[model samples]
Structure formats: C-alpha cells, structure tokens
Target: MEKLLVVEDDIGIQKQLKWTLDDYDVVFAGDKSSAISSLRRFTPKVVTLDLGLPPDAENASEGLATLQEILSLDPSCKVIVITGNEDNLNALEAIKLGAHDFYQKPINDEELTVIINRAFFVSSIETENAKREALECEDTPIIGTSPKIMRVKSMIDKVAPTELTTLLLGESGTGKDLIAREIHQKSRRNTKPFVAINCASIPENLLESELFGYEKGAFTGAQKTTPGKIECANGGTLFLDEIGDMPYPLQAKILRFLQDKVVERVGGRTQIPVDIKIVCATNQNLREMVLEKTFREDLFYRISEIVIDIPPLRERNEDVLILSRMLLNQCADMLSKKFTGFSDEAMAALMAHSWPGNIRELQNKIRSAAVMSDTKLISVMDLGLDDTHDELDFSLKVTREKAEKEAVSKALAYCDGNVSNTAKYLGITRPTLYHAS
Candidate 1:
C-alpha cells in the first residue's frame, strides 16, 4: 500500500479521517514541524496539508510554508491542501505555491478520495514514462539485427571476457572505434580507464612522448614527469586508433612493450611495469603494409591475436532503415522537435544511395533532415538526396537473381556456415545451393 501523510490539528477530525482513509497506510501530524518530520521519515508520494496548523491556526502562513517545503523536498510529490470554508484566497495562494490540488473543509470524504486517487494515477504514469525514456536512451552500444552485425556481436561476446589483444579492421567511418570501446566495456578492466589515442592524428615528433612518459627535466619542455597513454591506461584498456598510421620507428618499442608488459619513459632509465589490454584499430591493410616494409610483421602478428572485421553500412542493407529511424529519433530529441518518421521517398533514397561514408554519412543525413523538416515526416528533398539517380533496376531476371543470392547468403549466416542446413532452410537440394553460392 502507498503511504499518505495527513496534517490536521483537531483530534476529532483526525479520528474521522483515519476511518475514512482506511484504504491507505496513513500517518497524521498536527503541526508544521511534525508534518515535515513525517514527510522526511516516510517519504510519502502524497500529502494532505491543513492550511491552519498549530501556532498559526487562524492563518494560512504555517500551512503555506509547509506546502512549499514539501514541494521543494520532492518536486514530484502530490500535495493536496485543506482549507476552511470561504478560504478561496488562501486556497489559490496554496495552489500557486505548487500544491497538487486543494480541498475545502468541512471535508467531503468521497470527493477528496477521488482527487487523491487521480493524483496517484498521474504520478504513476509520470514515473513509468521516465523509466521508458531512460531505457530508450541507453538501449545498447551496438544497434542492428542484420546477420553480419549479429556475427560481430557474437565475436565480441566470445572475446571480451579474455585478455586478448584485439584488432578491429574496417573501412573509414565504419565505427571501428565504437567496436573497440564496446570490447573494453565488456572486459574485466571496465572499472578502470579506457584510454584512446589516434595514431594518425598525432605528429611523429610528439608521438613517442605521448605514448611513453617523460621524466622531469628530460627535455626542454619536459619540466615535470608526465605519464604516457600506455602508462595512464595501466590496469585498464588502451585503444590505439589508426594503428596502421603509427610511425615505423616506434613500432619496435610497441612490439617490445607488447611482448614484455613494461614501458621505459623517454630520457628515463626506469622501466615501469603495466597490466593492460591493448585494442588496436586500423582502416589500412596491415598485411600489405608489412609486405611493403611500411609496417613491422612481428608487431602486426602481436596485435592481431584476435581480429574482428566490421562491415560497412552499405553491405548491411537490412540495417539502413533501422539505423536511420534510431538516428532520426535521437536527433529529434536533441533538437526538441516532433518527428514521426520518414516519407516514402526519403526511405527509398536512404536504401538506394551508396553510403561511401557508412554510418557516419547516414547519421549526418538524418540529423540534417530532422533539422530542416517542418512537418512530421522527413522527405527526400529535406535529406538532400537525389532519388532519380538512386532508383532500383526493375528487370525481372536481375531482380530474381539478386533475391536468390541474398536469401542464400542470409540462410548461410543463420545456419552458421553449415551447407546442408542452409540448403534445408531454403528448401533446395545441397548441390543446387552450392552452385548458387
């Protein structure tokens, strides 16, 4: 049962209320101080304040102050003020001071009960709505139901629990960094820091000092000792983004650190030991770079202990609409706008366009459309996409071949690369399925 606080000075009225409000777990107080004490102790969601408390029974000053304090303590609390007959002015003042509602005395049990029930209902609705909003905001790190993305999630689940050096290989704007962070979040070191640094963004001259700490007076600007990214990420996960762009000279030191969990600071003699998990990401082909002598083969082998390949958004065709809707809703909430959905033309444009920039490009388009759209649904023109150029080819033979290929591919993924199971699922012979694939 929900708790209710009743503030009334008269003993006779209190007894009558206890009988009338037998449905609730009610607590009674006769003065402002007692009422506040009960409110703090019980933390009741609903309260009844008599606008004529002990010291100031003839006036509404004490009750009004109690009402303000109650509202201040819990802004979501429902405060129903009780006033004497012909006290409309004081009742209005109580309402202005943030009371939920007011009931004039001689108290009518039936009418007041209705008001109390309604306030409880409203409070419950608001509480549920707040919960739903929180859930929607923190849904998941990776969002998609496509087979390829599902495979990626499965890989992450398998690798996150161990202390494996993970390597994320993907195209530019394909969310390699997001995958890296997800791995760290699911790892044992989640409680510690998850430090990230972009190798390509930092210049060669400062990269060494940034990765390894410098002792005080080691260099002209190195007046005080400072820890590098690897040292700062001790007992945590260190994310090296764009590792393919790392300077060739520094590759030997990184390899040594990986082989032996220790780092020697620049111009320092001591080698500090560290316990950390390294997660590296790169858009370039490290194997090709190694063959060309641009990357160290031993370092590449050390980092790629566990490899996860992130597919481009265009490749995950089924996820385009899902990602677009989610991104649009997020943008709308941030911009404080009401957007229902996308127009038919806008959705077609989204699916048909080749997203060279992948998820990043899709997010930009949706955000732009949400800002420019005046109506509930965003149109193709608002997205600034040329639907004419993105029109699908409607040839019967070509469409049939494309559908058959997609069905086979999805079946293969769903069956975990089992040829017989995929053939059975597609209702085709094994040899036929093999030829189609």
Candidate 2:
C-alpha cells in the first residue's frame, strides 16, 4: 500500500476520507503546519488538500500556501485540491498553482476514489520512468568525442530543462532522431509518453487524423474513437520528424494546435486540450522553401523556437572514427563475435571515405564488416572498401571531397558548363556544386 497524506481541518471529513481511502496508508493533517509535517514524515506521492484550513477556515490562503510548500518539496507529488461548491474560482487558482486536480466539498466517495486511483497509477508510471532514465545514464547509445558532438551534448544539457519547442536541422541519417530522444529523456516530461511521428512518411490524407485523432465513425474506416499522437503524448513529448515534408494544407492545422495547445478530432466539435513538449526535425532548407512558398513561414517560426543544427558526418571531423568503433563493439556483442578492433588500413579507409549517408550508413558498413571479418581485427577488405581506398587521395581532406570534385568536373564537361544540368547529374544543389568547384 502506498502512502497518501490527506490534509483537511474538518474531523468528520477527515474520518470519511480515511475510511474511503483505507486501501492506502492514509495519514491525516488538520492544518498547513501539520500537513507539512505529515508530508516530510511519509513523503506521499499523492495528497488530497483542502482549500480551507484552521485560522483561515473561511478563506483559501492557508491551503494555497500548503500546496506551494508541498510542490516545492516534491514537484512530482500529485496534490488534489478539495474545495467548496461555491469555491470554483479558488479551485481554478489552486490548479494554476500546481494542484493535480480538484474535488468539490460535497465529495462523492466513488468519484474521489476514481481520481485517487488515477493519481496512484500516474505516480507509479513516473517512478518507473525515473528508474529507466537512471538505467539509461548507465549506458547511453550516443557515442562521440568530437568537438561538434561535444557542443551538441552541451546544448542538450542547457535546452532539455526548458519547455521550448526545438527544431533539429541535419542531413538524413545524421542521428537527428537520436538527439530528439535524448532531449525528451533529459526533460521533466521524461516520465510521460514520448510519441514520435514522421510527418513525411504518412500519407497526407491520414496525417491530420493521425495527429488530432478522430471521433467514432468519423470516416468510412473509422471503427472506433481514437486519441491521436498529440493527445497520447499529453504530458510528454511529440517528435515530428521531416517536418519540412509535412503537407502544406495540414501545416495550418498543426500551427493552430501549437498556438492554442488544443486539438479537435476529425468530425468532432469538441476541442481537447493537451500539454506536450514539441520537437521537430528536418533535412530540407526551410528558409529557402519559405521563400519559394512551398512551406508555411509562420509554422516554421512556431516550431523553431530553438534550432539545433547537427552537422553531417563529413563535417563532424573525427567523430566518424569514434562512432565506427563504438558501433563495431555494439555489433560484436550482439552477434557474439570476438572482434577486438579495426586494422590500421581499415581505420585509414574509414577516415578517407566521405560518409554522405552519415551515422546510418556507417552503422550498416560496420555491421556488414563485423559479420564478414575472419580475424579478430576488422580489415578494409571486410568493410568492402579495398578497391575504393586505392582511388582515394587521403591527402588534404577526406577522399569523399576528391570524389565530389571529380564527379562535379565530369558532370560539368558532360553538361557543356550548364550549372543546372551539372548539378542535376551530380545530384547536388547548384550552390553546393559551385562551392565544390
């Protein structure tokens, strides 16, 4: 049985509450001072606080002070405020001051029971999540030592504690999703759900309903009522990946939801309020798209209150080698292989190659090499880089730059110096190709 501190000045009401909540190790308090004492002694996860206590029995001053004290002691505590029938204003004020929920003075045993049970269930979930976070700290998936990565780590530390909407800008496979999860895990909302949706992956027709949910029989296939990702992530995070690819029409609805913190299900008239931290990721150049009128500029600004630009592996300097080794070790353990490390030639090849696909590409290459390696050390041949390494310059910078330059030069010749055609053939932006040239 979990401890529950009930703070009520009325003896009759206190007795009724204790009897009703007999399942819990219920402790009673008559005033603000006694409530604080009971809170320190029992450290209850849930507290049913009355709005009128002792010397100020006719007013809500004492109860409000107690609520503040309880929250200051343990922010996670779910304090349910008990108020008189005419004290609706006071109850609302208590909610603003961090009371989890409020009950009217003439309490129905069944109704109060349901609310307390919900608080207990929510408290249990939060406790489990806190433990899981601690375990995650013991072994993290993020592996890097580069200055760029270090800066990202520092930024995560600073930004995660706040409730700002964050935008992760990076090339595909550069671990944007991983960083989003890291932010969620480090936030106060970690104990709640972390719902992720790739705006680019779902069809435009279904994306709206997927986000805002739908009423029963809202559509032909709507079998039952469903709460969408936004509602499901009510107290946690909603990660919108590839937000640039989100359909232009749906962007307005999303913007509306973000602005109001409320959403109405498809075919539903009721607006359901939700509380969540929004984190969005995109690979596209949003500012350029805004200028081209392909994306909503206002929505872009709304989601990008805090932008974190994650450089590609090519720009990450030596993080490639560091990530490669870590991935190799992870693969070895999973596959039950005896791989110690990579060979000198393998390391050279890894350093030389331009990882255009970034972390995802590197992971795939390492997994393949780990499985193919015959000796304890993984070699360049095992990684399928033997033939390519010979063509690489390995002089000024990575061989990928050399490859890019050669491809661009040939494309330019083939296109007869036409920038557009050259860029098209090389599958790069004109600005990118011009910079390369």
Candidate 3:
C-alpha cells in the first residue's frame, strides 16, 4: 500500500483523517516535531501538514518552519498543507515555500483523497523519466576519422572555445551525444559538470521539473528542495539531446532561460542565476519544424547559433573499412577471439553495405562477426555480407597497404587513438604509422 503521513495538531481531526484514509498505510503526528520525525522515519510519498502547530497554533511560524525542514530532508516528498479558512495568506505563503497544495479548515475527506492520488501519479511519472535519463547518459565516446567526420571534428574544435549555443544535427545513432560530450570536454568549463538530458525520453508533464528542479512542497509529493538539470549544470554545459522532441509548452521557458540565464524552480518565487553553456542535438530538422509551427522560431535560432551537421556512415564511404577494422579488433579482444583480420571478401562486403544505423550498427555487426567467426580471419559470410561483390584488387602493394592500414587502424582504435601504443602494437615507430596514414 502507498504510504501517507497526516500531520494534524487537532486530536479530533487526526482521528477523523486516519479513519477516512484507512486505505493507505497511514502514519500520524500531532505537532511539527513529531511530523518531521515521522517524515524521516517513514519517508512517506505523501504528507498532510497542518500549518497550525503547538506553541504557534494561532500563527504559521512553527508550521512553516516544519514544512521547510521536511522539504530540506526530502524534496521528492509530496506535502499537502492543511490550514484554517482564515489562514489563506499563510496557505499561499506555504505554497511559495514549496508546499504542494493547501486545504481549508474542515477538510472534505473525498476531495483531499483525489489530490493525494494525483500527487502519487505525478511522482511515479517523474521517477520513471529520471530512470530513462540515467540509462541514456551511459554512452561511449565517438570513434571515426572519415573526411566527413574529420570536418565535424574541425567544426567542434572551432566552436568549443566559444560560449555560443551550439546545435548538432544528425540522424539517430550518428553519435550526436558523443559530439555533445566532446564539445563539453573541450570548452573552458570542462572541469565543471557536463549535464545532459534527452528531451525525447522524458515525459512532457515531468520535463519542466526535471529541467528546472522543484522547491520543497512544490507539488503533492515534493518533500525537499532539489536542483534540476539547469541548476546542476550551472557554471558548466547543458546538453539537450533530441531537442526537437521537447514539448511546445516548454519552448517558451527554455527560450526565456536562454535570454535571461536564470531559472525559477517550481513553487519558487526567487529566480536563481545560472551560468551555463547550452548545447543541443536533434535528428529532426528544426527549421522544418519551425515552418510547420511545431518548433519555436526564436528558440531554433537561439540554439542553432553554430549548427554542426554530422554526416551519417553511409555517406562517409572512406570511413567504413577503417571503422570496421577498428570495431573488429575491439570485438575480437572483448570476445576473446583470436581473429587476425577481415578476409578480402569481408573487406569488400564491409565497403559495399550501406549502414543505416551508422557506427552503432557497424559496431554491433563487427561484435557479432567476431564471436561467430570460427576461422582466424573474419569472412564475408561471418559478417552477414555474402551478397556483396569483391571490388578490391589483388596487387602486392595494394594488399600490403590495406593490411598495414587495417593493423594501424585497429591498434589506434584499441588504444583510444594513442600514437605511442598504436606504434608499439605494430612493432614500429610513430613516424612510420604517421607516414603511412
């Protein structure tokens, strides 16, 4: 059963609430001290706090202090402040201090139950979105050097030094997030936090709180004050991936923050100043979305200050075999396979196929091939590329160059592009690999 806490100072009302709320696993406290104590012990998702407590029953000072303390302890707790009919001003102040909702004197059991249920529902949604974001942030770095990808690297180098809002445009699985991380790593605030949020993964209702955070008692279940992504990324970079999927209602708030560099948490009257560099990425065309009235024009122009277009793997033909060799070696080591290299037909197959999922798809295929291959060399059939035709020549110089390039590429990839380790792996000096490339 869902847990609920009732913080009523009145003996009669406390008993009445306990009777009406029998469906919940209810805990009770008659004063501010006991209420806070119960809050810590039970950690209930919902709390009904009475703004009139002992020693200040006629005033809201003690009750308000308890509310603040509860929120300080657990920002995610939902707090419903119960107040007298004449204490409307105090109730409003409680809300401003982060109380989720307030009920007047002589609370109707049915109405209050409805509000509590809604609070639980909203909290559940926010919690799920938080989990999704956690999963999305566990991503690897970008790995490629096609001329198209080289151009993107050049663009990142050029833009990383600036405070200009950057927008990364690419298809899904094309490493937009990795590029975002690269930008954050290269920027002046590299030492600070690099907070990233996937706009598409979070629910629309919860996105606002997740972005801007919430004050204690901000909503039904908010028990404490917690900083949001924007606040967490203060003095650093805020990467909003899948920016095109952000809800239209939220566009105005984002645009406002971009303009003012300030954020006001939910149920908060004070504006917190935040100094953050904004980086956004999206697979969809925001310009087209803007034309279609789906995306905001001002927000689009603001975020796309220096847009970097990342070309997909299918378009970067030269990068295929190089990346494949790198991924092949990586998979071989990870899977404990003694695969020496890809066969001639395998190379042709790697070059021939159009990778719809880009580098991500390539990595998966190579990993699968490495595990499935029985021979020392990965065959075309092992790579699931039997239909592809062999286009490579069988000349001595050409064969030698291909072998050298593949070995060097694999070594460099495994060593995370370290020159010394790559040279050591190939049993040669840095200059030799440098000259070959």
If both were scored by TM-score, which would come out higher, candidate 1 or candidate 3? 1
298 in model 1: Cα distance from truth in Å?
0.3
Q: Model 3, residue 200: displacement in angstroms? A: 0.4
TM per candidate:
0.62, 0.58, 0.57
What is the lDDT for 172 in model 1? 95
The parts of candidate 1 lying over 4 Å away from their true place are: 1-139, 390-401, 405-437
Residue-level lDDT of model 3, residues 307-419, one tens digit each, is 89999888987678767876887777787777788887788888888889988888888988888888989988888865546575645346657776887888889989999
Q: On a 0 to 100 scale, what is the lDDT of residue 188 in model 3?
A: 97
lDDT leader: 1
For model 1, name the residue pairs that clash. none
lDDT of 2 at 34: 88
Per-residue lDDT over 215-326 for candidate 1, one digit per residue giving the tens place of the 0 to 100 score: 8888899989999999999999999999999999999999999999999999999989999999999999999999999999999999999999999998998688878988
Local error of candidate 3 at residue 309 (angstroms): 0.4
Q: Return the lDDT, model 1, position 3.
A: 80
